[model samples]
Structures are given as structure tokens and as C-alpha cells.
Target: MSNVSSRVSLSDWGLEPAVDYIERVQRSDGLVPWYPDGPADPWDHVESAMGLSVAGRDEAARRAYDWIADVQHDDGGLWATYGETDGDEGAHAGDEPRKETHRSAYVAVGVWHHYQCTGDRAFLEALWPTVRDALAFACARQAPTGEVHWAVGADGAVYEDALIAGCASIYKSLAAGAAIADVLGYGDARDRWLETRADLGEAIRSRPDRFDRTWESKSRYAMDWFYPVLCGVLTGEPARQRLEAGFDRYLEAGLGCRCVADEPWVTVAESCELVISLAAVGEAERAREIYEWLFQWTDDEGVFWTGYQFEDEEFWPGDRPTWTGGAAVLAADALSGLSPAGELFTERLYD
Candidate 1:
């Protein structure tokens, strides 16, 4: 139940408090609300659930998965946001809104991960219908240009934007699903899906202009610099050079990497992501250092602040994010050689 990795030490870091905080959030129905005092969103819940599973809370993790499954729409998609509720009516009714493709795909990633950890074939089989339909829905929204649309409103309209975050997520989900299909013995389908994922990666690399010119801008947001590289869409010398430039430009001494050029705050998500990016490029020592730095943001309860502002005064607002913890677990898993999904893509077939 402890994260006793030989390569990293947690002795003086107050890890137990952070672990307790993660447990608290898990017990509170796997929802790490963004604002620390706001309503729970599905996105954070999915991420938090994965964190719980990583921390060895199998029962709680399964409950979190059940929570997501219980809220799925009739069309097999999940809402972008939701309140504390247990039924489809709660998720589907009210003025609460939902987005397609991105949110749905994200939830599927968590579910897929849970299945991988548990080897729960029946659980996966039960969700396979929903996962398949969700994949189809996401694929339907993919433009001929290979960019997946960001969202579909509850009104059934498309919100078309090449959000780098969403695009990165879709790539990961598709890759995960393709691997699952292969394991489930859908070899032909797996190859087809893998091919689609490859094409999408190529599109992302070849046509960065199509997504958002701002992402390609020299302004330097941590995500803009790191995500494409993390997703394996950016590779070899180009990715290495880009990450190095980001390090030189935006990294600070005590505060870690800034989300943007002018920002003095260090976001946990971005910082953790930077660790993964560093490892991806074979900078294991630096990556481990960054990972250790991430622990400083953890509170007495294992909850990490989204970020810390350092200019006028210091503050780490809100509850720890599921994405923050998820990123941590993912980075650790990658470093420890335990990510089954990562194993499936050993050769970067997409490139």
C-alpha cells in the first residue's frame, strides 16, 4: 500500500498526509472538486479514481468506476460536469451540461486502466459496449483533417476546436482502446484503429497550424510545449530541442516550471507532466528530480494544490486535482516499468 519505490525516497516529504488526503477524496465518492469548494466534475473524478487504484484502494476504485458507469448517458457518453448523484436521471436531467468525445474518451481511459490493473474481464466486457460506442462517437466527430472535435453539446451540436489537451487525450485513449481490442482478440479491428491513431498523430505533427495557432506560438505555455511531446506526436531531435527550450525559458529555481512565460506560479499538473516529458526523452535523472519537486506541493493530506502563486503572496488554492494525482501515478508507473499501455506502444508505430 506504500509507494516504496527504490529509485525515489519519500521519508522526509510528508507523503502520508498527501496519501490521507487522497483517501479522503476517494472516500468522498472519488470527486476532487476543482475549486476545493465547488461541485464535483466527472473529469476530476476519473483522474482521482485512477489515483486511488494506484494507491491500492481496489474497492474504492471500483466504486468510482461504478459511479461513472451509473452516470453514462443513453448514448454512452458522460457529462462534462455533474453533481453528487447516483442515477442516470441526476446526470442527464437538470441544467447540468455535458460534452462529447473529450470527456467520454477520458472516462474510457480510466475505465480501461482499471480493467488493466484488475484483469477484470467481465467488468471490461460489461463496459465494452459502452466503450465501443463511445469510440465510434468520437471517431464520427473526427474531421477529415484528422483533428478530433472538442465537444458535442447536450443539444447535439459540435464545438469544433483543436484543443491540444483534448487532442492529446484522444490520442492516448485511442491507443489504449486499440491495445485493448488486440488483447480481446479483435486483431483486424485493432490494426484498423491503430492505423487511425497513427494517422492522427501524423496530422497533429504535420499540421500544427490547424489546431490553434496559439499552441504553436512562441509564447510558451508549459502544456503547449510538453503535451505534443508527451503524446509521442513530437519525437526525436525536434521534441528534445523543444523541451530544452522550454526548460531554459520557463523553468525557475524554487518554483518548478511555469505554465506560461509570464506566470510565476507552478502548476502541479504541468510540473508532473514535465517529469513525464523529461523521462520520455531519456532524461531519467532530471525526470526523477522533477518528480521529487512535485511532492513539495503536497499538503499534510496528500492533496496537491493545483499550483502556487509566488509574486505578491503565496497561495495554493482548491482541492488537489485528480489530473494532478493521475499525472503523478502515470509518471511513477512509467518510471517503474509498470504501465501496460506503455508496453503496447514500444516502437512508436504512429511515427
Candidate 2:
């Protein structure tokens, strides 16, 4: 992180090609497949959509949000995988893809981002009901322990499990929901959501045992290590401390960030996100260092590879995810100050 100033400028690393990579694979109906023939997950689709918005492709971005509104289930959660041909997980082959709490809640984050970019009150109004219902669905499953369950079936049966990464995401989604509620004139609702977010952050910090009951602690996963900071739940000195805690475990020197603390694989999207997490707490020097390192992951077509295996010294899984390009564009905007919503990822969780 010492040579934070060692990057080519954002103007040289301009985001249009990366943004277009996502738009090119998006269907007319606004589904952004992970790849040309891949399934669209709600969260990744939203991410690609945000990148579109950042690239000044407003119409495509709005269409992306519209697709979410059009397909929202009565129960409010988004189908984890929709109209898919393939998935990273073999589980989505079912007729009805499973629902997940964090994926369902993420519409609020995308909705708020759209509003921030356009200042379109009418657009916010159009999306308000979707945001409100989605957050309610996730909140309804919150345990007395202050952790939201990891997922729920379409039948409404809860998984009753939790994850540090998922809950951290939901915490930020609630902040976005609260922002929407404030704009839509829901004082009590906004205030209540803020209160819940504070409680969730406490659980994440104090109760590591509350999460990932079915598997080993996900602290090994880079997302869980950085999400609280990315979400603004762990800001200022605490955020700085958290980044320091994970730096040696994950950072790969002149390479990129590790996908897992113990693994030799580094991923583009996680590295991009960590840049924002670093910037959120005034760690701009470190943020730029990582972004500069991540530039090495970009391919000739301007799309970033999904991940690289340092042990084998190659791009593993050997595919480019549209969302990875989206993440790169987003991180570039954060560093370049090129868009209104550039700071979206780094913004504070509560007013």
C-alpha cells in the first residue's frame, strides 16, 4: 500500500469499455447474464445495472430497475437466479430458483443508487413499494439475536442461519432503504431501520459465533472481512483497524487481494470493493494502491478476469464475469469522482 500513487490515471483507465462489456451481454429485457450464456442473479444484475448508470447509460439502467419491479414476488424477495441457462452453483437448475434474504434486500441499495444518480423523485416513488416490501421481508426474519437469517425458501420457510457477509450487506441495504423511506416521507420507518442497523453492526462485531453455523467461520472469505467497513457500519478508527486486521491475511503485494484469507486466489470484484471500503475510512492511499494492482487483472477486451490463482500464477475458473467489470467500473468512479453516485459504496450507513 506504500506506493498508492503508482497508478495510471483514471482517464487512462477510463470505464466505458468495462461498462459496455456489461451492457453488451444484457438482454433486451434487462437481465444481465453473468456471462453470455449464464444465469442472472439479482445482486449481480443490480451491480451491472449500477455500472451502466455510472457509464451514462441511463436508459439501460432504468430498464434494469424496471425488470426487478416487474418480477418482484408478492412475498417481496427476488428469486436468487432468474431465467437462467447456467449458474456457478448447480442448485439453480430447479424450475423456481431459490430465494435469499440478502439478494432480496439488495434492491433497496440499487433503488437508492438510481435515485441518487438521477434525483428523480418520481423514479423513487415508482420503486418505493418494492424497496419497502423487500426490506420488510428481510427484517421479518431477523432473530432475537439481532441476526437476520441467511435465506428463505419461496414457500416462506426460513433457513435460520446467518453469515457475517450476508448480514453486513443487509445492514447497508437497510441504510439505503432508510434513505428511500426518508425521501418518501416515512419518518418512523426510516428511524426504525437506522436503529436496527446499529443493532446488526453490534452483532457482527460482538457475536462472531452467531454467523455461519453450518460451515466454518467465513472470516476466511474476504467479503466477510471487509463488508462491515464497505457498508459503513465499521467506520473511522474501527474501519481502519478492520482493514489493518485483514491486510496481511489478504493483500498479495503487487498482485491483488485474495478471495479467501488462506487461499492463493485473488479476485477482481473483491479487490474493487475493498478499494471503496478503504476509501470510506479515509484510507485513500491504500485504496489507490489496491486499485493500481487490480489494473493488472484487466483483459484485452476491457473486461476483468474473475480471479487469478497466485499459487498456479494464472487466471483460474478462466472466465470473465460481467459483474467483475461492473465492480471495476464502480471502483474507478470512486477513485476518479466521475459520477454523482461514485461515492455510493463509501457513503455512511446512517444519517
Best by TM-score: 2
Model 1: residues >4 Å from true position, as ranges?
Answer: 1-16, 27-32, 35-37, 84-96, 213-220, 337-351
Scored by CA lDDT, what does every candidate get? 0.65, 0.82
lDDT of 2: 0.82
For model 2, the run of ten residues with the poorest summed lDDT: 1-10
Error of 1 at 188 (Å): 4.5
Best by lDDT: 2
| lDDT (Cα, tens digit) per residue for candidate 2, span 171-192 | 9899999999988999988988
- Model 1 C-alpha lDDT per residue in residues 1-351, reported as the tens digit of each score: 112343442223334344445556554554555444445656667776666665556777777777666666776676776654444322434553556576677666776777766777877777666666666667778878888877777688877667766677678777767766766787776676676677677777777766764334544677767877776777778878878877877777666778787867888777777877777777777877777777778666566778777784565565566557666666665555443433221224335
